[model samples]
Target chain A: MTEEHDHSGNPPQPDEDRLAATEFEILERALRELLIEKGVFTADDIRIAVEAMDRKDPANGSKVVAHAWVDDAYRARLLDDSKAAIEELGIDVGPAPNLVVLENTATLQHVVVCTLCSCYPRTLLGMPPSWYKSREYRGRVVVEPRAVLREFGTELADDVEIKVVDSTADMRYLVLPARPDGTDGLSEAELADLVTRDSLIGVTQPNAPSGG
Target chain B: MSDQEVAPAFTAGQHVQVKTGDPPGHIRTPTFLRGKSGVIEQLHGVYRNPEDLAFGGQGFPKMPLYLVRFSQTEVWDNYDGSPKDSVLADIYQHWLEPGAE
Candidate 1:
């Protein structure tokens, strides 16, 4: 994860947001209680679902990118059929809301944003960064992507094209950033180490290995 | 839901126009891209309509979703990025119609 991915650095949610969060929590609890009482689903099942979400993080996406960087076959599969490719690596991305992988090539760059709302691939990348859900990002990224990338300290050359993918509904996109130069000798683990959560989101490119 | 009933109406590389007119209730199509023309980059298979899913409806009659690509120049008149640059968005079949070349 990069500096931008550090949720610890994020400012505390505002009073209204906090209140909304509490309201949602209470509603969720009430619904769960009702469901349980109606014999729809057990509390234990809800707990397991919560735990599964907790277990997911950027590492899942990093591993997938690292594998693609090292293995052409896997990369082909990923681009051709992302859900199946990811599942081949033993990560089931649930049944609904399909997942799509976008590759960043030398001539093209990919960025992900949800303009309508904060619809993200939570199962694969854990919770999105606070900034990701902010109205500023959602509103601007689609209209002024280069400027937004500049704000994130990413400056691209004029020749490199940028493609902003708006995760509007059922589809979730993960950016497969171009492998940095001078990483030819790096192992898959080492390559994954260089890939950051921000890179997966396409805010910035992967950090090149130091002193390689 | 399996896509056995309806064959996908569009294919990758085919042109499409995002339909205009707002339907009340939860919608996945963003206003910015509505009535815009773009090319279908990929077919995302069949899935239950999320608009129906949002409201507790069964989200029935699976529809083919697509990754649509529109040039920055096409979507916005004053887009700051390179004209070659484009954007991709996931849109449902209902929101798209065949586009003029």
Candidate 2:
């Protein structure tokens, strides 16, 4: 006879099948097909765009951060004209919204959110994480940023000022996290490894240099 | 409409308050910021008004957008964070008026 394991601790879970497509998904499919039919663009064009977007990741932003940490002039240029500085690294920002780099100082911190919608620097950091686009994050981060940062395991001294930037229009912000302590000897490539996606978002600081 | 014909109504370091209203259609101004006071942080040049563009109209006479900085204490009554904490948002010219510093 087949043996049935005890089910006390483990409840029956739902099947792992894909759910039906959402209304928005259906609408998007319909719109895509209509646009292709009208010769706006071919299916191949859409596929290529999607693939390109998928390839963009936080490493691009990490490289920018690492370079800024090592070079004072690049940091200045990044703060003054972020788009040009970013492009100087051979990174294409495309026709995205103007990029603004907010420098985190000893006495101040910066965090970013999109209260209106999910506006992000996709070309530099890939698509935003699911939480970045969630209603709770979009709503709470602006009002209680410190608390939100705490939830992300980031704690700041009371004296440090927190600046929350709400991307409401044609501008996207990238946080330039302060370089971690005792990494003066690290190379630019090593520094880039320390930068994290959360650091770029200002939710947390960069990871400490390994073994130091 | 041309942006060249009209200059921006506000400039950096100017104090302004967001216009409060519940007008219909594609408004980018956050409701929490309405009637709140802030200082202009930077001018982001002119752009087509999203409100107009939402309905397929040419967002002409592009409006000047500025990054407005608002204190968290002033924005929220029970702001538990430090008084030094502040929030910044990109605001359009049409949604602002002179405010007391």
> What's the TM-score of each model vs. the native?
0.87, 0.92
Q: What is the lDDT of residue B22 in candidate 2?
A: 89
lDDT of 1 by residue, B1-101 (tens): 25433458999999999999988999999998999999998888777888988899777787788889999899999998788889888899989999987
Off by over 4 Å in 2: A1-23, B1-6
- The alpha-carbon RMSD values of the candidates against the true structure, listed in the order shown, are 5.9, 3.1
The candidates' interface RMSDs, in order, read 0.8, 0.6
The deviation in Å at residue A63 for candidate 1 is: 1.1
Off by over 4 Å in 1: A1-26, A38-44, B1-4
Rate residue A8 of model 2 by lDDT.
Answer: 82
Positional deviation of A22 in candidate 1, in angstroms? 7.1
What is the C-alpha lDDT profile of model 1 across A1-212, one tens digit per residue? 34355457777444574454577788988998999999998989988988988888899899999999999999999988888999899986776367788999888999999998898888788889999999999998888899999998999998999999999878888999999999999999999999999999999999989993
List native contact recovery per candidate, as a fraction of 1.
Answer: 0.88, 0.94
User: What local distance difference test score does each model get?
Assistant: 0.89, 0.92
